[model samples]
Target: MYKRILLPTDGSELSHACVTAGLEFAQQLQAEVVAVYVAGNYQYPLYVDILPPNGPTEEEYQAAMQTLAESYLQPVREAAAAAGLACQQVIQFNDSTAKEIVHTAQEYACDLIFMGSHGRSGLGQFILGSVTTKVLSLCLIPVLVHRIKHH
Candidate 1:
């Protein structure tokens, strides 16, 4: 009987599928939802001399990421509203998305995390490092991984 569910999305097709399912489940439970989107922070050097002349400044990069996050989160908001569920949306810019997700769950007092996995295996998953896997490793709360098997 999870009271609050955290749905973390990356705007991928698979992620959207998970969010949709999560929303439906939350609707059934009549639980509050927390939708979170994490954008990567700009980590490159900010010195003017070391950067390209036409390259965006750190502030510009941050603004762009924030805008992107808003776009990614908009659908979740609309879907939650349609489901008549209470949803809290959060946008975070951080290099480590898994950490941010765990933090958001803890900060919001979410009992469960519902998120998607690309279902990669072997060399690809090894090299790419699955954020979902990392979140599973790090987070204490229950995580329902919606593993999408692409054909």
Candidate 2:
């Protein structure tokens, strides 16, 4: 029933599974997929003066992050093409992953968001904060989280 599906991936093995599942679901529903990669703005450490002399410049770090984000989204684009489904790629530079994801879904008018869950423990989730959890709580749209099992 979904007309447009948003798939947010981080290029991790867990996210790869979600990409595969989300694409299959989109194919079945004849829905368009919007794949997004969110990159946080990198900030140099405060003690730059005392830091290593050969540290990468801010511009260089940003470029590398963008390149990595592109690599993460490339396979998703190819998979969509192979499935004969219309797809779009988005790159967002924001600090809050969940906020960016929700904003993208709203901006794109996507009905469903399919993403992977890292499946952190309760304590770990509390300490590190769970992006999927935050998205679920904040998003108005329906979210389908694929939890990958580690063997």
Candidate 3:
């Protein structure tokens, strides 16, 4: 019973799985889809007094980040088009991805969020933490987590 489905993707294979599942659910519910990519924030300090300057330039880093964020949306866009659903996309650069996702959902008036679960086992999950878990903790909308099993 979803009217607006928000799908956040990162261009990972797992995210693709999530998109596929989300598309099916959205189609079944006759819902519109919103694809979002949250660019990880840049928090490093600017160091202009380095000895030998051969590192990536500020403009280069920004361009690379933007490319990565946009690249993640390509497959999702194709999938939505093939499914014949009304689709929209947004790219956000945020320190907290979970927070951005929840905020976007509210901003877009989405009813449900379909996302992929990074199937990390006990120890790995404990060490790395999980964006999906964080999103679930803060989101007011329903979240469907698609766990892609790796063989």
Candidate 4:
């Protein structure tokens, strides 16, 4: 009975699988979908003298990241359109992926969060950290994680 579903995608194959699953669920429930992409803010060292001369400025890097994020969100928009479901795309610029996802869901009043897990285990997860895991722990709304099996 979800009226609004929030789908966070990183443009990975696994995430696309989650998008398809989320769309199917939304279609079944006759709900709308909000797809979000979180772009991490580019951080540079405070010592400008150590930077490369050809490196992009902070504004340029941010713009490039936003463009890439829009490209990543395009497929979700098209899929939702083909399914004839109401869809909205949001591009959030923040360093914390999990926080942005949860914040967007709450800001939009989404009833459910449908996301994909990277399937990292043991030391990998511990060392790299998982955004899905963080979202699960922090989000107030129900989260449906789609785990893709890699053969």
Please give the range of 10 consecutive residues that has the lowest summed lDDT in model 2: 120-129
Off by over 4 Å in 3: 46-52, 120-129
Spell out the clash pairs found in candidate 2. Answer: none
Model 2 over residues 1-151: C-alpha lDDT tens digits?
8999999998876688889999999999999999999998877778867755787787888889889999999999999999999999999989999999999999999999998765445554334238988999999999997765556
TM-score of each: 0.87, 0.86, 0.84, 0.88
Candidates 2 and 4, the one with greater lDDT: 2
Error of model 4, residue 50, in angstroms: 5.5
* Residue 144 of model 1, lDDT score: 86
In candidate 1, clashing pairs total 0
lDDT of 3 by residue, 37-57 (tens): 988765455654662365556
> Comparing 1 and 3 by lDDT, which wins?
1
Output the worst ten-in-a-row residue range by lDDT, candidate 3. 120-129
In model 4, where do residues sit more than 4 Å from their true spots?
49-51, 120-129
What is the overall TM-score of model 2 with all chains considered together?
0.86
What is candidate 4's lDDT per residue for 71-98, written digit by digit as tens?
9899989989999999999999899999
Q: Which whole-number lDDT from 0 to 100 does residue 56 have in model 1?
A: 81
Q: Least accurate stretch of 10 residues (summed lDDT) in model 4?
A: 120-129
Among these predictions, the greatest lDDT belongs to: 2
lDDT of every predicted structure (CA atoms): 0.87, 0.88, 0.82, 0.86
